[model samples]
Target: MTEFQILVVAAAFIVAGIAKGAIGIGLPPIAVGIMTLAVPLDDALAIMAIPTLTTNVWQAIYGRGLLRLFRRFWTLALTATIALVVVAATLGKLGSAQASAWLGVMLVVYSTIALLAWRPRVSRQTERWMNPLMGIASGAVAGITGIAAVPFLPYMQSLDINKDDLVQALGILFIFLIGALTFALFRQGAFDTANTIGGLAAIVPTSIGVWLGQKSRDALSPEMFRRVFLIGLLGLGLHMARGLL
Candidate 1:
């Protein structure tokens, strides 16, 4: 990568890390979304795989009752993984423009839902079947767009889990999703040595940004921060979607 590309990647990840640190999620969406402005979708996705995997691994293990939660959500994990691999192996051939458009759609949809704070409660009875089904759908989106946020985040948030558990569960799900995505991208030859090294290099700025965000989380208003973040995403989404035209 050129110096300019490196700087762009660093800046994007720093912002993504801050969001993740502040809210316990959002690293991939922010990182990939912003990086796409400077790099191709495949390159952005390749660069994100390692950093996202490592960070979320930490997030997943930090909380209690993981085994129990994993057992409950294993179907979701399995279904998402399988679907993601298939989509990556197939639709990944459509090239950057298509993938970028798909990503734009996902970001806009997710941002809109987040901005509205419209929480749809999923009944316990519905959740029994919904988890795996949603996994399939989310995996397809992730495979095509290199993001697993949309329905996955919303679905998890709708659960009855406590704050800490919810955070950890999100980490676990991301770990699974990102891990699978890494393999899928590799199968498509997306991760070259340079991109992998770039991903590692990004960890430094990302960590710094996250630390700053964590420190500021107490002082800032979460609602305000989230609103601003979503609005930015909405704009980025529109910019990305224009590629399709």
Candidate 2:
């Protein structure tokens, strides 16, 4: 990668990380868009797999005790993640453009539904079934486009989980998805020398962004953050759609 490209990827990482840290999501869509400007989409996807996984793992395990949560949702999370990995692996070699276009459409549709609905409620009994079902759907999206936030968002919100638990659950879910994607990408030979180096270079900025985001989290209310994130998703979806079309 050129010096300029490295700088761009690093900057993208920092921004993506901050967003992920503060909002508990947005890294893959945000970072992938930025990175694609500097590198191939597949390489960007490959490089992003690890950092995304790293941040989610940190979110899942950082302050929240894992044992308590793990026992509760491990089955749902693992099943969803694994399902996506299998789907993604099956679609190997289609390249990232088609995936990006599909991702763009999904984001726009999902974000639109989320933004319009208020007080969306689901019963606990429904959640039990929805969890795995959403996981299967999310896995399919994540595998195809590397963006799985859409399917999981509504379910997460309906649970009325506190901010910390929401973030933690998202982090755990993302870690599983990213880990699966990393392995799938490797098996598909998505990583090359340049992309590998570029992905590694992004780690520093991404970590810094995460730190900054965590610090800023308390200043904003969860509702406000959610609104902003949804808006951001809308904008990203539009931008991606325009590019794809």
lDDT tens readout by residue for model 2, 1-245: 78887887887898788777686677887788677667766787888876777677778887655777666567668777788778977876324777777766777877787678744777767777777787887777778877676667666777856777777777777777787777778888888887877677677889998788777787776456657767877777777677566
Tell me the spans in candidate 2 whose CA falls farther than 4 Å from its real position. 113-119, 215-232, 243-245
My TM-score estimates for the predictions, one after another, are 0.97, 0.86
Per-residue accuracy of model 1 over 120-196 as CA lDDT, tens digit each: 88876888899999999999989888899879998998987789888888888888999999898888888888988
- Give candidate 1's root-mean-square deviation (CA, Å): 1.1
C-alpha lDDT of candidate 1 relative to the true structure = 0.86
TM-score of 2: 0.86
